[model samples]
Target chain A: MNESPVIELSGVCTRFGSQTIHCDLDLQVAAGQIVGLLGGSGSGKTTLLREMLGLLRPSAGRVRLFGVDLDDPDLLIQRTVRRRLGMLFQHGALFSALSVFDNIAFPLRELRCLDEDWIRRLVHLKLAMVELETAHGKLMPAELSGGMVKRVALARALALEPELLLLDEPTAGLDPDRSQNFVELVGSLQQALGLTVLMVTHDLNTLAGLATHVAVLAEQRIIAFGPKDQVMTVDHPFVTGFFGADRRKLL
Target chain B: MNAIPCLRVEPGRVVLTGSWTLATMLPHLADLQNRLAVPLPAGEHWDLSGLTRLDSAAAVLLWRTWGNAWPEALEIGELHRQVLGRAADLPREMPAAVKHAFHPLESVGRLLLKAAHNLRGVIALFGQVLLDLAYLFRHPADFPRKEFAANVYKAGAQALPVSALVGFLIGVTISYLSALQLKSFGADLFIVNILGIAIIRELGPVLVAVLVAGRSGSAMTAQIGVMRVTEEIDALSTMGISRSIRVVLPKILGLTAAMPLLVLWISAVALLGGMLAAMLQLDLSLNYFIENLPRAVPVANLFIGLGKGLCFGLVIAVVACHFGLRVKPNTESLSANTTSAVVTAITMVILVDAVFAIFTRQIGVPQL
Candidate 1:
């Protein structure tokens, strides 16, 4: 593993209207590690993800991505840092007005460096990467089925060839078969592109299939963080209850 | 790790190095494009093994630069070759956008069909509300009384201040302008007849109709449209509730019930404004204006005004509900339906008012 961390959260705190979600939370994700963030409902899993994306600022401490502070004042540096990571929202928040092709091409077009031909080719490559047909590009987001919506959203997130991928419930709505296919797709893509992934998921199948490292969050902090099997062996209530009888099957 | 992407031309070879990713290439894109455009020797060797990372964007650029073919002599890693292979495998032709040839006659026919279809939908919705009313009459327990009251509060009670403000301004403007004309002709008393008849019979209903159409009508469409988009309407139907009884009828009936009251309120306030302006400009006494108003404008005109208010209210509500129910499940459809609801309600109110004008002209007019 690389020594330098791709994401570092040190002593982070999040409070909402007299309710504290996270206090003094610290996590360091090294390069190319698929960290499955496990937590019970309302345990601030999505909140932590949003904090990392800079969509929400922690009340205290620092959030650093690629070794640069998210609070860095320089606009150009912030933009550069943002372009290095992509996030997939829980509901596949695709733009309703744009076609699937335009949605995927949106980030590339923002660069203003790639020409139309290159964008067209890159968009096709991304669609293929997500196992979608080229014809799917012509459909609107509203027209897509639930599975297709997830795929299209994934394609759009991967548009800029982001080094870090953040997925919030990537397979929440998919059936077991489709979710398995999605897991395999993501696993192969992660290996090919050497992407560091941070995913929040409740599905054990997804966790077992893809995550190289596991981080269990409880009591407003990460209770355990290490290689999957090592983290599973940690004597924490959340870890035991979460894995339950399926611990050996995961191995 | 953060070396700038460079393409160096050496003897008998082209060497590409560094992290050739989008972020690294963005600033030097123009320079790279310029250098890549220059012709190289036919049999030159290309070296890309030194590159630490290569994103698909860089792969596409390289694929395009090499004349859509591999270099004669090239040294590249297996992973880089796979990235390049994906780009090269992209289909040459893009999917074509759908096109239609313009035909004026067919276009006109389609528009007429659409209008007829909309008219049928409005009539059907009106019939459904009537049916729902009949059903509620037998089972008064099932009536959406709270929804009706809420709609009235939102559309009717909340609209009072704005209506009064607009009504007062129009009354002042018309009364002041007429005072100027009446003073020159020594017909100052005639100002009472003009203001009373114009405001009570025509302006009150039409003004309130337009305001209500823009305010309450658009809101009704948007509320129902969003419900449709989020499947709330479907959820309601799945529970065995008639949407027309619970959703559509309350809005139409509430607006219908509130509109006549709104017209009466606005007309009374507007007369007060006209009275104030008359006092300032014509030195007309309030007692004289009030006492003689019954004789000058006649009581039938007040009845005509209230009747027009009732009809205008029904038409506006029906038109608004009609367009609201027509909304499809998309943002574009929601916005389009809301706009069409407001516009169609106002237009229908004006059209109904014109018909009322022609029919009631003889009843409301005083004999000279």
Candidate 2:
């Protein structure tokens, strides 16, 4: 408990012209916990993730990562803070101009310290971890299939060995089998690297397989934040309605 | 925070400790590389058990430092071993880049083939539009009237202010410069003839053509290129709708209909600018200048300018749509195609203007 949380958001509020998304929302994600953020459609799950990434500033309150305010003006502090985290966007926002290899090598090359040999080895290792062939590295982003795009994006996210991994809809478009494989891949990687993952997903299967903690966003705040079983047992309408029939399988 | 990675050369072993992760190793990368470079003594071993965390980047560094093999006597945790195992399993060599040998004649032949292919594409697109036009004539209900009107507004009405500004500036410059020469020869009255013939017959159509090509031509290409990239064009095809009818024909017809009107508008504004400059520079009265314009420049020149504008509009639209439809589903292709569209449209405008000049050489010149 003495260790600071990886991500902390207190009294966060988001408003877009009278429509409020998050109000008085508070969350503290400890290190090495895979927290799945669940919400209904139009509930602003992605917006909350974007806020945590510092892409969208909350209308009020503070967002801190590793005990440092995300709004700090120091360039070096911002860069250092950003370097410790990686985000996988929903659509695998790969650089369309670069080949798969270059896209994955981008963060490593930005470090400006690693030689080509080390980068090559690390990139190939990441590719292997994501169950992709080295031959696939030469293909452009436009040529990749939906599942391959997610894998390549995951590889790129892991390129920097970030302690905090933020995944937005990690298994949205993949087939059931591919999604299961993706869940396993991420779960094992998280275990191996001790990553603190905050993923936004609506898929119950993905949430069941990966999440150590569940944070349900509803009515502009997190209604339940705890272990999956504990959150499922909460006496709330959203909790009861969300896990109605398949509650037994989740535990 | 975990301790920074530290390496010590003890009496009999190299002891490594602390968090050996990419974030921690980045600042001390050079120093670590220097320390790791020293050869271990014959009896020495590596002790990695004291490390708190070992990430992939640090694993790769250690794997390389040990000459791509485990040390003869090493101590490491099971999880760290697995981390290193991933790095150890990577294939040694990268896939080689494909290279093509250069050949002078082959390069020339390729360029010619590419040009011929592009010419064929343009001709095919033009023929498709003609077919679409005929279909629309047969069934008026199927015509894309809304799309056509939108195109006209976008390519023509939206372009008025900038075109007028440029046209006026060019007119004032040419008139002021020519008046100086005419004044030297005691022929100040000749300014009307020079300005009328030049702006009405040539400069008005060519200048507007260049501006529209750089403006609306690039826009059309980029719009259609994005449609192609996002598969919207294919969606149209799946719905039993012809893209040529809906997209291409409207742009070509709309721009063609708008171009002549724009030419007339810009030419009039330019003439007004020239008249003002002439009056100030040479004391030529506006009344005499307006009356003398008709007599100085033949009516045939006005027809020639409108004809040029019509042809330039058609050529620009066709070139833009041709390049647009050819865009591949990628960012690089979209940008390259848009650039090619504007450049080719402007070039085609000049080339068509030359053809107009040659064929109408005998028609437009006043009897001096």
Candidate 3:
């Protein structure tokens, strides 16, 4: 199968000051697959995600999205490719100044072609997809609980229907029940929309329950990468340590 | 995408047409939902077969309005049917809305209470700074010298050019106007007295205070506010660092030391500007204006101005730090605290200037 990779990272390296976070890391994510990027704290999972989104540049190697290098000389082409990608920041990064409806409507409004009515309907539809009531749309980000903020941010991420969805610790700070609900919701949405997802997470449950493929980052490299079951069996010390601790649950 | 969608209602039928897509203006969906919620005629039907274009967003809206299911009597094509059916399955649970009641008297009471609480916080911060200062004096080696020096450079050295420029301009404007009026009555020499007393005793200190309040004061609030927002202050506390000594005290000390020097610098530039304007407008010589200035305004006025500047700096720094520490963990609060800090600092400077005027009213007047 020669299907082109939607996300490609070859021999990537990321450094901050004297610290090297990632070294010679290679990864490829095809279309319509949920790839769980598992790593411990300070494992550079978030930094790698940032690198993929062009928010950070790798000291070495290249990041390609939709087969286009993000550092492509042509700005328009880079932006066009970026439009096909969506990111959910670690803290949801919802504009506290905006109501939930306005936050979701932001991307639609940026398109500048849709009328207010269409934007409202689309916003309501996205909200519904995330299981948020119509009334929740009127609340500001500060007024929302942690889980509801995540849901609202999820709706905003889906508003543009981006083909590639990048999530940074989506379940962090969420209670287990809410985290499971969020996972199920994301899984269903991914299937329905046929989205390619690269989720940075340390949650074993999320990986075991939802990831079609898994990439374990440790010691500045991917220690294991493959289908979840196969990666779980990798003989590396870090891999075994992580999987061993959660073997009963993962299996 | 091109054609706007419209919903037409007859007695027992709803006709949908045009491009019912994301780009279309579908303003009446809420109204349509409300209308449909009412008991309609028994044979009422939704006729979507007239639609030329349809998208998932349009279908979802229709699906939700129908209570997450297909209508009993409807007409639609295969593509439209699939979109609506899929949207009908999406989750749609939301908590009930919260209603907040407004009370005019209670609102006013709350505002007054908030102001009092803020004043209490400012006084408490001032007391805390004094304690920190006492502790620092006892243990001089533990002082945050680097932080204090950086703050001094930021609030003092970097600010000199702009302060000098504004001071010069203000002095020129004031002196030029006063010269015109003094010249009309052929009392042109009195321009030196007016310019000297105003520039040295009153204008210089107040002008520098206002400038620093807006520039360095707001910067102080925003910097500390951001630190709080990012939890850096909390991290410092966790690391056993005293925020008052490391952060707030340094800013206060830096500003206090800088303000008097700034006032002196600004006064010099302003008097130069006044001398220039006097020589040009009143045909008075620069030498004559310079020689007459000391006798006209006296050296005591300069000391008064410097004292005022020192007091203004202390108030502004304390107020800025107070508001900065009060910032909530949000961008909105950060911006609000920064603005409040600047406004409150300027107001405190003006109030203190008034108090100084009343107290030192006779101290610096030329005993003519």
Candidate 4:
């Protein structure tokens, strides 16, 4: 209310035909805050992210990112916004055809006007951050282990030095140790790089350990949104139920 | 019920109207005109007073019913202009070919252009395969060690047995035929000529190339097609890796490099097989057959056979890649494309062989 929030949502509704996936939802993220998008699968966390990204238009209500209405998404604004966002998709979704270097170079190739040498240099820098061997840059994705694939894809997402990092289940399909390592890598990078992070994850350790803020989506709306410690309280039944979701509840 | 808008026909200067939504009543117009052949009414002016709404169905129906005689067609001016307007000037006198520019005929033209583009893409793909072959040495490192081993195993080693069997049968038949013919001249020694000339010069390379085309060509298609379906190709593209460079070029290079080697080996083996048959049929000594075989044929014939084998290798690679690219994103399409690749490669091989046959004769092929 004092100034425009980093992300502002009001009465946002998304529907597919008669099935109303999310309706009349509202949430906000203040400037420079990392937020956890917490929900079980099919609970509209991804859809909400997509809506914020303007990939899907809300059937109703206003979504203002920093100040831009997501409904009438300005292409120029979207491009600027996208340049600031780094998305780590499920299974890392690393372009299987690319080498580790090119995989890391993708966003730079797409979003930046950097030449090959600079792109290569940036790729190696990112590879070092993820602690992946630069020699693996020459190998195809099929040659990599699951953990390395995730690291390379993460490196690609960071290629453009994005301000906002969106991770969709970053720790899924990893061993507990690898998952913890990935989360640590993300938190340390968030601090060092001064980035805003919005992550969709079912990992309890991520919420407890990595998040600065948390937003729990239930009944097609954020039931609670605040700093991680405040939001983690067992006040709402849905929030409690989700918090109690076991480690085995995830993929 | 009071007449609601049934069909509001408006196209150019012709108008016809009825009281019903067009979708339900549109089919009735066809039935009304069909079988009975009763001329539905038309005039210089049409009545749209009975109509309430207008759409595409009514517009087309009116045009088809009165297209021949109507000096010009009726066009829907606006919803409020419910009656047929003045007779618009239209070039009805234009030739049928000229009018064909306006309608369904344009769709036919589109079809032909599509076919042409598809054919152009195919020809372009063939060139791509050739270019890939020419540039093979530049990036030979792109081929994975496993891929090379597989290509050698799949294309060369695996294919030899079939070629050997075919070559064996062919050798036995040639020996039998030679013995039957050369007995008349009491020059059963010509069986050495038959075994040497036939196996080394023509049959060996052609038979081996055909065998590889069926086996290796089909395998390439299936592999690429599966990759296409599985999004492995997309994985490559999104990875900023060129499928042409990484996936396709390697196989083409492997085949081009290995094929001539295989052909030469199989031909020698096939000749040996013929030597065995020569012993059985003509009771000819191995040394006699082996020694005379080289003199009876020249290097020119070997060159011809090897050249054809190279061309066939290129053709198989291109054909397989073509069908692979043609594969729809489905397993069924993968299977279909694999079959088509083999069939098309073989067909093209035969057709090219005929062309070569005609060409060599016209050019006065150097007789070995």
Candidate 5:
């Protein structure tokens, strides 16, 4: 586990037309650790996540995930890399016409050429883990409420039993009870399944409860980053202000 | 006044017979509007053959009635057929007395036929029909079976009532029209023969296909066009399914196979109507009329009618597909495409019929 870092960003810079979002950013997330990418609305945490996912090319510097240059994949590592990753989009993005079962089965059908028996076993097991009964499989996405959708999206993303789980704004629209449940689920899944996780969020309770390591992104840089208590104790104005506002809201 | 004491007014398939001058029509306009107020059937063939006498004022009233009564905001394919359908049927509302007064070009039509001595127009029209038929398959696999069957039943199956009615009416109409003129020449007995030729050859195939086009073709276009906008089509592409082979081929095959039978069915019913009308008007027995059909109508007429049905099916399917594919995601595009599919399908059907008329003239074309 100590060979090298799983993810490394050295002086990553990104811009859009005339505006610079991320400037000379340096960060690293190690294997088997759940890291939080924290920021306010316009702070570009999502852009940095995209860079780590290899969706966006850094304007400068480099990003490496699992010792592979994400921008250029070497042929030997293609199957291992793709098979090891998963993503949960902000809105869950389930196809409305497809039933919940088919929604979870979508990625499995796309990626694995498995027989129906195996796919059914995997899908049912994951759905049960998310506490969705097998009979709920027939319901369409529109019929499900917000919490159900997130659980289903999570189940779909976890279909491959991925090593790395990248979630963007995973708990954006949930009520406090549901948000707490989701955070608990994320933690349990990570520990029980040995999943390495990187997530971007503005959820303070989630940040405090689940993240083993945390980093603040602002001014196109990682302003402060360390283990949970260390990052929380920093005196940086934005960190103090960001966490202080969250503290006030929490109280 | 030069006009007759009585005129007829109709708002779609329903009719009210009476004088429709400015004074008489003004009172009835409200009633007509109310009748037209009934929601238009899914497509254009709203059964408007009830008008026995038509005029410019009634025509404008019907056109304006369409303005208020028409649901233009629905899928364009439906609107397209309904609007064009009323336009084509409007001319029929004119009485034969009036048609003769207005149709100064009838002599010219006859002269052109005598000069050409061929049915090139029918062949060309059939070719256009084929092209239109091919278009429905643009995304074959994306077919919505529920909607397609609904449209087919609406367009093809639902058409039986009117097709029977038209055939019956055409039988009587030609009998009465011919009886009035031929009585002076003592050829009133030949009314059965004329009715037989007209309905079996032209009216039978063309009318049935037009009904099919207005009902089913427009529905087909709207169904596929909506699917295109909904990203169901995109999902098929992502799944590696060809929308055409899946969505349209079944419809095309089903319709293509069924149209010939429908045409034959419509034509036979129309001839039965003519036979009944002849018996009522000219003292001809059904047995004698049926015996005369083999010689006067011939089996080639059946073949021609069947061929026309096949061509019309092709025309309609292709036009629906073309317009459906042309529909942009916006509402305006739906209307435009639907309108074009109906108008294009009908005009092509008529033009094909005319060409068939020309090529079948006594010359080199084989009988069957």
Candidate 6:
């Protein structure tokens, strides 16, 4: 890991009207690590991920990704920094009108510098990476099943070879068998690409083998952050119930 | 990285090794599957000891070739065992394959059933909105005033530029043609009579109705349809909020208020266009055109036009919300409902216009 963190948040505050989601929260993710963010329902795991992705700004703190401040005044700097980050939303969020091929090719096409042949090759390569058949490329998003949608979404996120990947509940809807497959896929993808990933998930099985570090959010801030096993030993009530007392049931 | 992924089968065993990942870019998987499926001996063993690295993609390819299971005679260490074990459990993702052969008659029957079901859904939604309206009449606090005002601005005020442009162009064409024909008949002065009645009574209402149908009608349908897709409508219902009051009623009230105003605005702009064309083609003065306009097209024609506008607005809003709530939780359904809302609203407008023409025939037309 590098000395400078891939992602850094300091003294972050997020509030909606009278409800405060996070107050003076702080987090850091080293390079090439997969960090699973776990929290109970309404614990603001998704909100923190959004803040890190620059989708939502903290009320009173700094959010930095790849050493670039997300709230920078310069639009060009924001765009440049954002281009290096990729996000996979809870639902696929694929363009409905476009075919799977076109959806994966969207970022490349937006760049306008790649040749058609190169774009086609890269898209095919990505589809293969996610274990999708070449014929499936022509299909629309509605025709895909829940598992396929997640795979396609992962492929799209990897299109630009982003250094940091943000995932919103990567395995909320999949069956146990499929969720295991998803976890393996995410694990291998992180290793292969050397991606620094921040994932918000409730699936404990996903955190078992996939996450190098685990961050537990409770009372609007991270109560525990460390190696998955170490964090599991934390004395907090939510942490204990989440990792030790109810591990078998949750997993 | 130097180790190329390769599969070599000998009499006793199959050997696999190399950097097999998405980045490594292996050859076509199907070709590899074919080579491995050539009836290997029953006791042939597999070796992965030489493999430097393995990822899910590569493991999946190997698993698929092995008939979606780990080989019984596989010779692998604990590290490889754990890696391959994860991939072995994946349920084969069955693509949405059309199972039965295509039958034209059966397909046509299915489509008809779907249409009938959709019609029933729209009617039910309409009835719900009507019931909600009755309830609102008794208790008004449940109404969402902010949302109503916002929708009015969206569906009415913002639509001004495009509606004005379309109305003006249509008016220019209609008046220019009528002026030329009237001139040939040596009755050039009758151009005002023709333009006045048509712009105020028929053209203005119909044009505004069609424009709103395409513009605001589609927008309303799309907004509600997206809410349906994302389960926002469900959340509202779960929270003890009536969707009809919070979502549907405001749109109906807003468009109802805006449509008459839009009709009047379109009529004014259209009349201006007609006056311009008359001045150019028939050499009619502005003063004469303005002064003769009230006598040529009585105030009754304006009222009739506004009446049609109000009715058309009600139908469009109701129809848009009806189809919107009918949308399934899919992108295909959202686009489909939006298109259907626009088409249905326009058809209803034309049908209503025909009825309006017959009933108000004597009221708006000036006697010769």
Reference-based TM-score of each model: 0.94, 0.97, 0.74, 0.44, 0.43, 0.66
Off by over 4 Å in 4: A1-3, A71-74, A245-251, B1-368
Q: What CAPRI grade goes to candidate 1?
A: medium
lDDT of 6 at A235: 90
Q: In model 5, state the lDDT of residue B77.
A: 31
* DockQ ranking of the models: 2, 1, 3, 6, 4, 5
Worst 10 residues of 5 chain B by lDDT: B90-99
Which one is best on lDDT? 2
lDDT of 2 at A160: 95
In model 3, which runs have C-alpha deviations exceeding 4 angstroms? A1-4, A9-27, A38-44, A57-64, A67-83, A99-102, A108-140, A143-151, A216-226, A229-251, B1-59, B64-69, B73-153, B168-191, B235-250, B273-291
User: Model 2: what TM-score?
Assistant: 0.97
Task: Point out the higher-scoring one by DockQ: 2 or 4.
Answer: 2
Output the lDDT of residue B23, model 5: 26
Report the lDDT tens digits of candidate 3 across residue range B98-178.
Answer: 557999999999989988998999899999999998998999999999999998899899989999999999889998999
Instruction: For each candidate, report what fraction of the true interface contacts it reproduces.
Output: 0.60, 0.78, 0.13, 0.00, 0.00, 0.09
- For candidate 4, write residues A85-186 as lDDT tens digits: 678877777766566776777766764343454345445556766777557777767678878878887887776656567888777777888788777777
| Each model's DockQ score | 0.59, 0.72, 0.16, 0.01, 0.01, 0.12
lDDT of 5 by residue, B1-368 (tens): 11222323334333334433222343344555566556554445333333322332343444444552443332223322332343333322221111245466887898688435323433443454455446545744454566456545656677778777776777677777777787789887677567767777778888788888887788878888888867677788789866665565546655665677778878888788777777877778999888876766666776777888988887677667667766665455677778877887798789877887788765322243
Which portions of model 1 show Cα errors greater than 4 Å?
A1-4, A59-61, A67-74, B99-110
lDDT of each: 0.90, 0.92, 0.84, 0.68, 0.69, 0.82
Model 6, which residues run further than 4 Å from truth? A1-251, B1-3, B8-14, B27-45, B63-74, B82-96, B100-126, B136-153, B238-241, B359-363
lDDT for model 4 comes to 0.68
Residues A1-251, candidate 3, lDDT per residue (tens digit)? 22669999999998889999999999989887899998888999999999999989999999999889989999988867776678898889999777898899998898765556656767877887777878788888878988888888888887876778999888888888878888887786675556789998888888777889999999898878888788888888878877777876787
Which window of ten consecutive residues has the lowest lDDT sum in model 1 chain B?
A: B90-99
Question: What is the alpha-carbon lDDT of model 2 when measured against the actual structure?
Answer: 0.92
lDDT per residue as tens, model 6, B26-107 = 3344455568668776666898887766654466566756776667788765665655665664445533324489999999
For candidate 6 chain B, which ten residues in a row score worst on lDDT? B21-30
Clashes of each: 0, 0, 1, 15, 29, 0
Q: Candidate 4 docking category?
A: incorrect
